[model samples]
Target chain A: MSIEIVNVSKRFGDFVALDSVSVSIPSGQLTALLGPSGGGKSTLLRIIAGLETADSGRIEIEGVDATKLSPQKRNVGFVFQHYAAFKHLSVARNVAFGLEIRKRPKDEIRERVHELLNLVHLSQFADRLPSQLSGGQRQRMALARALAVQPTVLLLDEPFGALDAKVRKELRDWLRRLHDEVHVTTVFVTHDQEEALEVADEIVVINEGRVEQIGSPDELYDSPANDFVMRFLGPVTELGDRLVRPHDLQLLTGGGEPDAVPGRITRITRVGFEIRVVVAVGEQLVTVTLTRNEFLSLGLQVGSEVQVRIAPEVGAVVGQPRLLGAV
Target chain B: MASHPSTRTRRGPVTYLVRLLVIAYLFLLVAWPVYLVGKNTFADGMDNINGILEDPDIVHAITLTVQVAIIAVIINTLFGVGISLLLVRYDFPGKRLLSALLDMPLSVSPIVVGLALVLVYGGRTGWFGPGLESMGFQVIFATPGIVLATVFVALPLVIREVVPVLEEVGEEQEQAARSLGANAWQTFRRITLPSIKWGVVYGVVLSLARSLGEFGAVKVVSGNVLGQTRTATLVVEEKYLNFDKGGAYATAFLLALVAVACIIIVSVIRPKEDR
Candidate 1:
């Protein structure tokens, strides 16, 4: 089901958690609400799920105004960040909670629980308590439980936040595949940009209780709506009169081109697949990334003379720099 | 990191001296008195026990005390769970004051609690006593009066036990259950109750112990009528004053044994609370 949020606002005493936030989530696509901490992304997600009430505005789920409806009536499933599994319940019972509450037939509930356990790849652990499982296993069980009742919308708040880095990467890919299989309209809040870029079909970037931009990963990376979006997506370097991304700058061994910005290399560091070169161009410092083959071709070292170039067609202009704090 | 048993450690002679002093103080104050009571009760062996057991008044007193304790524990468990839920889950005016008032039974002496109940529900001049008597029911100096006194003294145990557990568990699982289509009652029965079950058990144990051994308040309100309102402690007091030394010590020994059993049961069932 598609979700349409219009002019929603929320306040916690003196703090404004959401300010007229509006966004449309298309049906059957996984969307990520990405922002820094305290940016109100989680608040917006909770409001849409009906887990929290908005001070103003309406939420429509598939042409139905859901703002006045309770979370149960909205047919929305929510997975908490910490899993929140019942400690007294086994994995099978946890997954069967929603269906059991609906008073489904005993045989049907058992069958559905068995099916969900298999889908989450936890069939063997059906009889184990939540404490007996690892962090990733607990999260997967939480996902299966949320999906048991066949909700129209699935909302998750930092579902993989508590896991280690290696498990997080694994679960991200697993979640992407599971979403593809289920095809449920999903909205998840995340502070990690790489996770959002890799997993979401569309991203809604929020900052200070406002929508900064909404687009696909490539659209956000190539052409950001403002300096906030640009700096939020990745590192931005200031050249002479323009702001450009590190990947957009080119490094050269010889200063032949007239448009090239000449500088001396200060540091060369290999980070995964890309080699980063920090250069001192006059009084300004600029960073450029080159492929291993390109760096090998240049035969460059630290304190070597180099020239940087960003062709007119390749370099996208980001806004000028300002002091970084609340914004 | 390894050290021999004879090795000199960071802790000096003062630490050893302090530990020895604390152990001696507790043993002298607690263990010695308990030993004397046990020694006195069993001094004449089976003859002393048979003498107390043969007395019909002593048997009736023991039975009454057990019945009153059980009834008080049941009533308090229900109200205790309700009050704990209200205190931990919601915020409202006078919440702090309400919590403070729940502790009044603990701070006030049992005799004072009995007097307070009497002032509210005693003779025709008291607040509710006249209305209640006119309705063909009696409260003061009756079974109900004794029960009220015991309930008042045991009220705080269950509430104090359950509140901390409820606060620690939080509303996360309850919210999860709600979003999963469970209503308020279902959520409490399925999620909330099971989570706090251990705390309630611990509280009920304490309440049972307190209600069973209650003497001051029961004595003040019960009138100590023979075979009517006299509990085991009251019987023990009367027997001691009559110079029936064996009967008094035997009844007192029985109450102490029950209290010790309660402690053992509680320790056996206590969850390790991993944190």
Candidate 2:
């Protein structure tokens, strides 16, 4: 289901958790509420799920007002960061909880529970208590439980936030595949820019209780609305007065190009297939990313004098420096 | 590198001394007195126990004590779980004050609690006693009075146990339940209750022990009427004061058995539940 949030505001004592934030989440799309910690992304997701109340706003789900609806009435599935598994209940029973509460037929509840457990790849652990499952398995069980009710919108608050890094990556891909198969309008809150950019069909950047920008991953990365959005989406380094991606800056052995700025290489670190070179340009530090082949050809090392310029094709295509500052 | 020695195998003289002191102190304060009570009760090889079991008044007193204790535990469990949930999950004015006040029963003397109940619910001179008696309900110096006293003395035990568990368990699972289309009642029944089950059980056992052993409050409010208001604890005092030390020792032994059983049950269940 599509979700339209309008003028939502939330306050906890003196702290403003969400400030007049508004965003439209399209139906059947995986959207991420991305932000730094305590930036109100999770709060927004909770408000959408009716787990939290907004001070002043209207939440319209599938074009119907849901601001006053209880979480049970809203029909939005929610997953918590800590897995929130019913510790005493077995995995299958946990998955069947919503159906049981809805008074669904016993046979149907069992069938649905089986189907969901299989979907989450946890059919074997159905009879085990949640504590017996690993972190990833528990989170998957939580996901299966949330999906058991066939909610219109699936809301997850840092669903993989508690998992280890390797498990988090696996779950991210798994979630994307699951979203494709189920096609439920999904909204997940995360502070991880990479996770959002990698998995979400659309991204809403929130900061300091306000919506900073909203767009697809490439649109947000390539055309950020302000300095915060740019700095948050990926790595950016100061070049003279403008902030530019490290890979966008090209390095030359000597000052040849008219627009090239001279700088001294301060550090060179090889990571995977790329070489990250930090340059001291005037008083500002700029990073230039070079391919491994290019770095070997140039024979550059620390303290090597170099000239930095935006790549010619990129500069020509953009027609101006990518100035990502407060706008 | 050499492996470090295990600390368990390295106990020093200080540790031994401390362990000895604790054992000696427990023996002197608890074990010795309890042993004497058991010995005295069996001095005639179960004759005293069998004799009390046959006495109609003593049997009636024991039955009445069990009934009062069961009722008090029920009331306290319901009230305790409800108050604990409110304290842990909701916010309102005077919440801190209410939380602080829940421990009053634990700190206040049982005699004072009974006197307070009498001052409010006593017949003839109590605040609501005359009106309540007119409406066909006698509170002070009656069965209800005894129940009230017992309930008041054991009130905080359940709340004290359940509140910490409730706080530790948090509201996340409850929220998850609600989000899965479970209503408030279903959430409590299926989610909240199960998570706090151990805490409630521990509290119920403790409250049961306390209610069974209640003496000062029951004394003040019960008026200690023979066969009607005299409980197990009251019968112990009555038998001792009347020089029937054998009967008193037998009753005390039974009460002590129950209390020890409660402790053993809790200790047996605690480690498993904690895991």
Candidate 3:
């Protein structure tokens, strides 16, 4: 199901959790509400799930007004950051809860629970309590429980936030695969930009209770609407008056371009296949990234003077005057 | 390892002294007095206990006390769980005031609670007593009055136990259930109630103990009629005041036994829940 949120606003006392935010989530796509902590991404996801009410505006699910609908009536599956597993219930029972609530046939509930558990690769732990499972397994169980009801939309609030980094990456790939298989309208809230960039089909960048930008990962990284979107999506450094990616800043031993700025190499560090060179460009320290082959050929070291220039292609896209959006 | 040994030796004397003091304090304040009560109850080889059990009036008082206690516990459990959920899950005006007032029963004297109930429910001169009596329900000087007093005194026990657990467990699971298409009642039954089960059990056990042992409030509200309004605690007082020492001791022993049993049950249940 597609979800359309129109001019939604919310406040907690004097704190505005969401301004007049509007966004359209397409059907059968994995979309991410991405932002920093307390930036209202989770609140917007909750409002879409009917777990929270918007102060002023409308939510339409599949073109049906769902602003005042209860979460139960909205048929949106939600997964919480903490797993929110029913501690006393076994994994299978947790998965079967929604079906049981709807008074589904016992055999049907069992079959569906079995199917969901297998889908989430948790069939082996179906009878185990959630506490016995690892963080990743518990989150998978929560996902299975959410999907068992065949909800119109699957909404997740930082579903893998509590997991360790390795487990988070595994779940990220698993969620992407699951989305491909299930093809349900899925919206996940996350502050981790990498998670959003790596998994989501479309990304909605939210900040300070408003939508900053919305596009695919490539679109956002290549042509950010503003500085916030650029800085948030990936590592970007200010060169001259423009924000550019570290990898886009090229170093040359001899200056050729008029736009090239001279700087002295302050430090060089090797990470995996890339080398990071920090340059003291006037009062600012700017970092330039180089491939291993490129650094080995240059034989650059600390105290070496070099000229820094933005890559031509990247410069053509991001070298425009910075546009400052609403705070 | 060398530093640890030196620290341990230095702190050993003070630790032992504190342990000794606490043990001595508990033995004198609680263990010794309770042992004496048990000894006196069994002094005549269960004769006192057997005699009290055989007496119709005493038996009636004990039965009445059990009934009133069970009813009060039921009322308190329902009210306590409901109020705890409201306090933890919802926001409204006066929520803090309501939370503060829920603890009033714990801090206020039981006698004051009984008097307050009487002032509102006493048939002769109470605010609503006359009208209630006219409608064929007698609250004061009757079984209902005793129940009201017991319920009042034990009101906070369940809420006190359940509130922290409710807060700790949080509303996330409940919201998850709702998002899974569970209605309010289903969410409570399947999600909220199970997560808070241990808390509610602890609360119910405590409320039961408090209701069973209530004295001052019951004494104030109950008219102390020979067999009608008298409760077990009242029987203990009446027997002692009337020079029937053995009967009083026996009744007190039974009440003490229940309270101790409650404590034992809680301790046994606690470790399993913590796991």
Candidate 4:
């Protein structure tokens, strides 16, 4: 009912591709393998899909030895980084390919292909070849095809990577809904932190071919296991040679400029609902996101003496503060 | 802030130069031959080339070439795809060696390929010629020998094309096919073939072209039986030897035309990227 990967290590010649990677994905849950490129996330997904075999370790899906199984025998579904749909077949035919291979009654396969295509909201395009579909549609067709067999586990590798920004954002929500409806154990690989946060129930952050951290998205963002996870989870910039997020700082209104505060409002960014206030904390200017009403209320202009609050208790000291100012 | 998509990517001059050089070289070599063949095939009924156009002997040679090329291409396609699937998907002892050996045809000279076949089948005392004769079969200095040479020469082309396409093709569709209760044959027939169909077609057509134009290797094995074992290229050579310049040119022109036409069809029918 679940996938259990244990002590899996893959090596390509001398380089360690996956070092002792181990994790368990419970049935009916969506897990995200979040990492940078070459971080072994795709490697892990491929191993689970039986597209790759590890140098050492074990994989069990629903209490079966999946590591030893051929991809055809694993009963696991996979969606590649590209949709990888068969270009020659119509969408319905591609979806029914699995059923046809299984030698199901032809009528049954016809019924199932229609149902699956409808589920993916691609019923109208079912008769068209895969090449004619857009990127998002192709991905959905791939999903429908994978699901036609009613696989026990489903794996996707960067399913939205090839899409544009709008399509990628749209597919993220659609995919989550699809995963919820299917209620099958699934894992997807992604390098985008926002994608991992939005779609996955459990996010496993990987770095240098090893799992750096694994937890709920909020937990990992709030309390990262180490520096890498903290830096990776959100938009962070070097502040006084220390990592800091815009929301981490508190702005005080009318509190006399804190003694020794670095010189002032050098720039402003109009962000529709919010005006980003830029403060030159030294040679470096840091942008602080704020609402337009808040900026109007401040009524401050260029060279306005301002006091900015830094929660020292939260921001970790990274290096020499004075030296950063000189730069 | 959103950045310029074009400016976001920066390629070094070295990469640019390499790409341009390859494009130019391909246009020069592949494009030139293709243009010449196509131009002559449809050249405005010029009377000057009439002798070359009307030679019935050349028509016979063209027919012979097309027949052999079609048969040879079909055989190669079947065996090539079978072997490519085995190489990319399955694992067994000496798999690495077998994979490397697949390229032997491409690396070994065609002339030498003919010599190898001859040595194996008709060398003063071949390992199989006598056995084949006892079984009322023949492999050398006959039609079978011509076919053997053609197959050996065209073997690598299809496998090379199919393997990469198969490797890039996702395993999921085939896996999905199997889980749906498909047997091995069903998965191969439904999923594997569809996924790599375009690639296989392109490869087969290219192989056919090469088979039609193949000379030295097939010549050595065919024993040059006129109208029987004599292929188009051999026919062209015989016409040229007889000082029938017009007939030789016509045969050569027709063979070239078929090769060019096949390539054009392949390009036109090739699947577009991410279609």
* Best candidate according to DockQ: 2
Candidate 2 lDDT tens digits, A1-327: 399999999999999999999899999999999999999999899999998999999999998899999999999999999989999899999999999999999999999999999999999999999989999999999999999999999999999999999999999999999999999999999999999999999999999999999999989988788888888988887776676778878889966797688889999899999999999987777888889998999899899999888776542122234332211
Kindly indicate the candidate among 2 and 3 with the higher lDDT: 2
CA deviation > 4 Å runs, candidate 1: A252-260, A299-301, A304-306, A320-327, B1-22, B270-275
> Per-residue lDDT tens digits of candidate 1, residues A52-142?
8999998999889999988878888899899999999999999999999999999999999999999999999999999999999999999
Query: Stretches of candidate 4 above 4 Å error?
Result: A237-244, A253-270, A275-327, B1-74, B82-118, B123-146, B153-187, B195-275
DockQ of 2: 0.86
Winner by TM-score between candidate 4 and candidate 2: 2
Tens digits of per-residue lDDT, candidate 4, B105-138, equal: 8888888988888888873467887778778887
Write the residue-wise lDDT of candidate 3 on A171-210 in tens digits.
Answer: 9999999999999999999999999999999999999999
The DockQ of predicted model 1 stands at 0.75
Q: Which structure among the candidates has the greatest lDDT?
A: 2
**For model 1 chain A, where is the 10-residue window of minimal lDDT?**
A318-327
Error of 3 at A313 (Å): 1.6
lDDT of 3 at A305: 93
Is 1 or 4 the stronger prediction by DockQ? 1
Off by over 4 Å in 2: A254-256, A299-303, A313-327, B1-9, B266-271
Q: Could you give candidate 1's per-residue lDDT for residues B78-145 as a string of tens digits?
A: 99999999999988899999999999999999999888888899866779999999998888878888
- Looking at model 2, give its docking quality level: high
lDDT of 4 by residue, A47-79 (tens): 887777899999999999888887778887888
TM-score of chain A of each: 0.94, 0.94, 0.95, 0.87
